[model samples]
Target chain A: MPLVYAGVCSHAPGITGRKHLADPGIRDAFYAAFDDMRADLEASGAETVIVIAAEHFANFFMNNMPSFAIGMADFYDGPIEDSDWLGIDKFRAPGNRELSHRLISEIMQTVDVAYAEEWLLDHGIAVPLHFLTPRFDLPVIPVNINCQGPPLTPLHRAWTLGEALRRAADAVPERLAIIGTGGISHWPATPDSGKINVDWDLDFMDRWCRNDRDALLNYDDLTVYADAGQGGFEIRTFLAVSAAAGGAQGTVHFCEPIPIFAVSCTIASYDLGLLDI
Target chain B: MSLYYVQKFLYELNRSADLQAAYVSDRRSVLDGYTLSDEEIGALVDPDIGLLYVLGVNGQILMHFAAFHQIEWHDYLQRMRDGVDEHGPVREGVYAMTGRVGTGECG
Candidate 1:
């Protein structure tokens, strides 16, 4: 089956961890958007969701990092930070080793990818799941791009990974939903944590919604760092989703700069129905 | 100088509850295994959020270390700013502070 859903969202730890500090008006609005995304995802009847996230040194470290990796475990446990600190309780989400095996087998044909039997979910995957799969009933296949460490995966290669994922998804019988989660333009974890570049974010989202490959791939890391802060590096996740959308246009459901959350708090998806697949 | 090892230690400590407990019980024992300068060792043992930030430890790794020590979010941000104020700029890595600090813009 073709991908049932394709979208992107923000997954900063602050989104869940520091919600109490944000303005109630904007916070509720963002929460409502997430709820709407959940509704759309459920309406798609997606059996499993493939979360493409840029993990912040949770499982993969500099010692041995894969440019791209997919989860292949029966169960995955999460939020690694303290429950009180992240404001999300520790929970184990289900995974299907056999299905992952099949998907990995397919995705590997085109892109050299790593498969992990054990994955500890960090906020990159945790925060998004907290809203997208609140019940933890749906199986999830976690994907990671090297966004944290230097020598990160190049943007073009990230696009290839998306194409590989779509090909793999199409090969499977189960309806798959893919979501890319990361910040657009903000500095996370440092003293400048909540600083957001609204203009940079808007420009990037404009490129993303148009599915303009050249425009999206045009950004260099140095320019992105100067304009969008280090967190902008995570745009690889978004670009991959754009590539997975396979030229279908997108819609920005919600986008607002919520400083306390440390991102432009966004929710957007592709019009996958436009594709003939 | 060995920012990699410094981050490696925090990376391990952040993920393992057992290591966190062991480090809390005997930090020196845990510190002995890794090749670390006295400053790095002090930063790890004292768990100085600011000094560690200045030493070029990625915020993603340093934030959990701060949380483990029970540092509040705002306090955590303030400590990093204080670290930079006293220690000059980040000596290495891509996480160097580029924006103005203490501008009341960030939370």
Candidate 2:
């Protein structure tokens, strides 16, 4: 399958309905860009989408966290925390089981990745999907990263995992759309939890838009943690998507600093360079 | 102090309708079941976002708890600010004050 589309979006729950809580202009600008991005995504003519988002200990508790896992089930009843407010009705989505199986087997056997048959579409996956595919009709393949757990997945490994996903997508004979959700910067739960690392967030966005993979991958996990705050680790998902896109550089849809949520919510589109390797 | 029980309490309330009903009808009695400290219970029952934030409950989880209480987004946010002001710089957990809130002042 030719990887037809790739992108990243930051997950800030309040934006779906409670956006009035944020600066009105920032909210309006983000949605305006996001609506345009969604239209482009809809126009991409993709049949199956690969959604890589964080699994916030919702499905697997801290006791049994996996660094990386792909859901193998045919359907999932989306997560609780976000479904309540995001206004997504019949909040379950059918999975692209065949593609998911291909990805799971390919990554597990070849790359030694983990697999899960029971991961609900948590806010990590749902918030972006709510905006990208509002009708819930698109068949999705949900891949998860451990953004909040310890013995953290090294940053480089996340990028390699993206490369693996690219290889997997190369094997399939269909058009694939991939989305990595979460991050720019925000510390969740800390005293500075609402603090946005504006400089850091913008720098990361600029590099990603420019497809500066070398610079992005050069920063070690410790550097990322120190600069971006705890929840900022979600950038691993974004980088993974960038890698999956063959490091194809593209336009940044929007990058708005949402102070209320303390998140630099973003939506960036990429040129999908179909990989043959 | 471990924010474990507080997060656990909020997680159940977020996922289970049964817990929601129990928490509302007999909030203390329901809290009695969890292995929470008195302070945790006090803050939770008060539904004090400030105290909970001060107590080191993760914002991602705490936000849901605030929403369940129908606290507006803006107010839940302000409560966190109020937390630092009243509780005196996050007494425990990951957000412990590293001697003021700026870089180059690192511990």
Candidate 3:
């Protein structure tokens, strides 16, 4: 089956862990957007969800980090954070090792991705799963783009990975959904945690919705750090989804900076029906 | 000033419940494994979040360490600001304070 769904959303721990701290009005609106994303994913008849996330130092550390990695296990357990601290209970999400192996093999044809048999979920994956796959029932294939550490994955390379993922998804018989989760223009996990660049975010989303490859890859990391804070490196995740969308236009479902949540709190996806796939 | 090891220690501790238990039981022994400066050792032992931040530990790792100590979110941010106020600027890493401190929506 061709890739059935492709979208992106925010995955800050504050989105779930600090929900009570945000204004209930904007908070509920943001959550309703998540609900719409879930509805769209379900409506796609997706059998597996491939979550491309800019993970923190959860699984990969500086010791031996891969620019890109995919999970290959029958099951994965997480919030790796203290359940109370993250406000998400501990649960094991199903993984399909067979599906992962095939996908990794296919992705390796184009992108040199490391395959991990063991992975502990952090908020990057956990927060999205809390909404997208609420019951933890769907088989999840986790992909990580090393956006945290310096000497990060280059922007264009992330696009290649996404293209590779789309190829693998289409080659497979089972329907697959791709959801990329990360912040756009916010400083997270620092004293400047709640800072967001609304203009920068809106401009970037404009390029994203237009699926303009040149504009999306035009950003350099130093400028990103200055304009979007260090967290802006996570645009790699979004860029990959755009690459996967294969020229399909997108719609921004929700986007507003909730300082306490530490991001613009966005939810957006491509119109895959526009493609002939 | 072994910021790498300091962050590495926290990275391991944050993900491992067993190491967390061991650290709580005998914090000193946990220090034996990593090559760290006395100041780094003291900061980790004290778990002085602000000092660690000024010492250049990445907030992604440091935040979890703070949470492990039951530090609240706002308190965690304040501790980092206080660290910068007392100890000059962050020594290393990409997470240095950008002087855009009070410009956030939360302010």
Candidate 4:
């Protein structure tokens, strides 16, 4: 049971300064932080990274939307929507089709996952992976958590998906590194969208990293999220991965406020003990 | 229903560089294609940030629309307040103000 690396990431920090990418240690710490994660990932003997990211109304719109989209396609071409800002070649993305199928069936027990074969990774999926590893060869099982549309997936349902993924990973022989990529209180598309609530973001980080589900999920109303920012809902992605990890505690790799994108980007790696494999 | 139309327009604008360019060049023609109400079209073209949000234009779509206009985050939040002052309350969207703006009532 090689469920070695499990954690959450934020993608906003390095977006504005492509220039900082030149000197990985320059303006942002995300580059160096990823370098460290790369070392850890190499040590963990983990092969596939199951990226939990939200889609920005790219694949599904008002006409057709699903709570979840599981990618089982053997091959993936990258970036369906133009993400020229990322500066990565969106031509082809490495994928793990088999594990994706396993996840679809596992997740279907509780939540019906719309199986996707032809779609490519969005910025939510591609940006983090590309930044973490220079080449992006580490196979990924992209889980597009639908956060864009209304009737969005509730926190509980997202947690259910996380729990299912944990069981699926442990039950099988695949060493899956579940990485939830998004959030820590920053709104991407709102008018005050660029403002990151450091206080709220830090509160979430402390509770989430310490596995404080009681405080984390104590919200009776979601306007609390709206108060934080629109992208605040993206944390549902984190909750799913957290549930998958069985509420295990993890190290907070880095949490920084990147005002350029008005999103807090971060990385944390968890070690959930093996399940009688 | 009108908010849905606004959201659709912005959603398309977000993913399409060509559409963004077209929007900036001639918003009137691009907006005319959509069957939006005068209020909806006016809010969009005039760049009424708050009214658009109150009108139920989902934040996901509205934020990018705000950015396209180079609206600062502070100004964007203020615009919503301004909309309350100028355009009445959020007429038919998610942010429709109930009892009072400061009150704990919004449905």
Question: By the TM-score metric, which is better: model 3 or model 4?
Answer: 3
Off by over 4 Å in 2: A22-25, A82-84, A110-112, A188-194, A220-226, A273-277, B91-93, B96-107
The parts of candidate 1 lying over 4 Å away from their true place are: B96-105
Q: What are the iRMS values of all candidates? A: 2.4, 6.3, 2.8, 7.3
Q: Summarize candidate 4's per-residue lDDT along A125-148 as a digit string, tens digits.
A: 766767765576777787877776
- For candidate 3, lDDT tens digit of each residue in B61-83? 89999988999999998888888
TM-score of each: 0.97, 0.87, 0.97, 0.80
Candidate 3 at A36: error in angstroms? 0.7
Collision pairs in model 4: A189-B63, B50-B80, B55-B93, B56-B93, B56-B94
For model 2, residues A1-277, the per-residue Cα lDDT tens digits are 7688899887766566456566788788887877887887888887878888876767765557788888888787775564546545448887867678877777765556677777667777777877788777888888888777656777778888888998888887878888898877776544455577889988888888877878777775556657877777788898888888886876777777776555887888887644331
Worst 10 residues of 3 chain A by lDDT: A268-277
Ranking by DockQ: 1, 3, 2, 4
Using DockQ as the yardstick, the better of models 1 and 2 is: 1
lDDT of 2 by residue, B73-106 (tens): 6566677777767775566544542322222111
Residue pairs with colliding backbones in model 2 are A1-A172, A189-B59
Backbone clash pairs for candidate 3 read: none
List model 1 lDDT by residue over A1-277, tens digit each.
9999999999998888999899999999999999999999999999999999999999999999999999999999998778899999999999999999999999999899999999999999999999999988999999999988889899999999999999899998999999999999988998888888998899999999999999999999988988888899999999999988899999999999998999999999999987834
lDDT of 3 by residue, A1-277 (tens): 7888999999999998999999999999999999999999999999999999998999999999999999999999998888898899999999999999999999999999999999999999999999999999999999999998989999999999999998988888999999999999987888888888999999999999999999999999989998998899999999999998889999999999999999999999999986844
RMSD of each: 1.5, 3.7, 1.5, 4.9
lDDT of 3 at A223: 90
Evaluated at residue A201, the lDDT of candidate 2 is: 87
- Weakest 10 consecutive residues, lDDT, candidate 1 chain A? A268-277
